[model samples]
Target: MNKAKKMLFSYSFLAPSIILTAVLGLYPIAWAMRYMFYDYKGYGQEKFIGFDNFRQIAEDGLFWDSVKTTFIYAGGKVLVSLPLALLLAVVLNRGLRGRNVLRAIYFMPTIISSAVMAVVFFTIFNSYNGILNQFLMKYHLISKSIDWLGPDHALFTVIIVAVWGAVGNYMLLFLAGLQNIPDDIYESASLDGAGKVQQFWYITIPMLGPVLQIIIMLAIINALKGYESIMVMTGGGPVGKTEVMYLYVYKLFFPTAADAGGAVQQIGYGSAVGFVTALIVGAVTMVYFFFSRRMSRTF
Candidate 1:
């Protein structure tokens, strides 16, 4: 076979995946971009309105609220989960008995579906007759059952659930990174009178920089893109207190009406919200990358 025919055969093999990606991924992105320039409803007619949708989005208070909520949710999840994961990884790396079993137990949550987890948490966080409240009451932690899904407590509940769902994955990441560090380094540090803290600070942390960077990046992206859990747990409800950007976008597209009660038929505005969200996520990711790179250099 000649070079051209070989190339053709290679291209033929690649065609299906390329075509599928274009159809599923690229097509919607392009369609969303196109719709962003228009006053397109969920269906029927679409009228081009230039930057009107963008302007409205800019002026929308709800959009800004969602943005704030998204940042808070993302920041809280990352801050809480990463350190906890690292700590757990370090503990597990100490070669304790049943460490593998404990790691599996921790990681099991990550493999479970987010929706399923949401349902489980939903039951756990039930304001009345909930296990958490019952435990609190039994232990004298609280005199009465607290409303976990109330307006004030809703976001906090979601954050706790988010952390629980996320920690296992990052723990596994850190565990793998921990294993990759040379045992000789730790032994040398120990010989030099370096304590556990010193060994971790001077050796382990430095070696884990690359893995830490990747984990942090993924955590930030996951936090920013969070939707399913919030949707299933709170439905972005209790007066939109837990309404992150994704759920806000979902609601914009499928607003509850007087008759339908919970209907979202505004695809264009949702697309516009999605576009804005993409921009925010991209900017945040860039900032994270910049800081991570700088930190890596420092180490």
Candidate 2:
């Protein structure tokens, strides 16, 4: 076939996906950009107010609070989950019976529906008569049942659940990176009288540079986008304590029926928040990669 025909044939296969993306992904974003300059519900007449939505978001303390909450949630998840995942991966990489079965068991949570898991945890973490509290009381750990979803502890609870669901996937990534390392490298290091800990620090980590960078980037982005479980579990809370960025956007755009009368339904403002969040996430990803590259170079 001619070069032009070959190109046409190749692009034909991609046409459906490109069209779907434009319609589903790019179009919504473009529409949101347009909407941010207007005041309107998702449907009906939109009156363009020109940067008013942006100004409103900047002035909204609640929005800023949500931003802080988002950072805290994401940071907590990454810090706690990634290290635990790496540890699990390292342990599983050793020669052990039923290691494959154990790996599957660890990864099972990652495949489960986030909403379902959140609901299950909701029952488990309930203030009165929950299994956790029951067990603790039985063991004489406390005099009273603690409210796990209360204002003081809701964010912490969310972080624990997020980490539990996240560790498995990242652990699998670390395992993949670990498996790719040739056995001969570890043998050579062992011959040099290097211990397992020394091999991991000086050899495994340095060698897993590229994979580690990708895993970190993915974890950060995923953590930043936390929404489903928090929604199902806390609904942004006992006084907005667990209201991360995505949940805040959801509340703005789609208030509950009971709140509908009081809620303004600020779709434009929500769009602005979404757009700004996208920018923030993008910036964070870039910064992470830049520092990651520097660290890789140093190593």
lDDT of 1 by residue, 145-210 (tens): 899999989998999999999999999999999999889988888988999889889898899999
- On a 0 to 100 scale, what is the lDDT of residue 67 in model 2? 87
| Candidate 1 TM-score over all chains jointly | 0.96
Ten residues in sequence with the least summed lDDT for candidate 2: 257-266
Local lDDT at 279 for model 1: 94
lDDT (Cα, tens digit) per residue for candidate 2, span 65-146:
8889999999999999999999999999999999999999999999999999999999999999778999999999999999
Write down the lDDT of every candidate, Cα atoms only: 0.89, 0.91
TM-score per candidate: 0.96, 0.96
Please report how far candidate 1 places residue 221 from its true position, in Å. 0.6
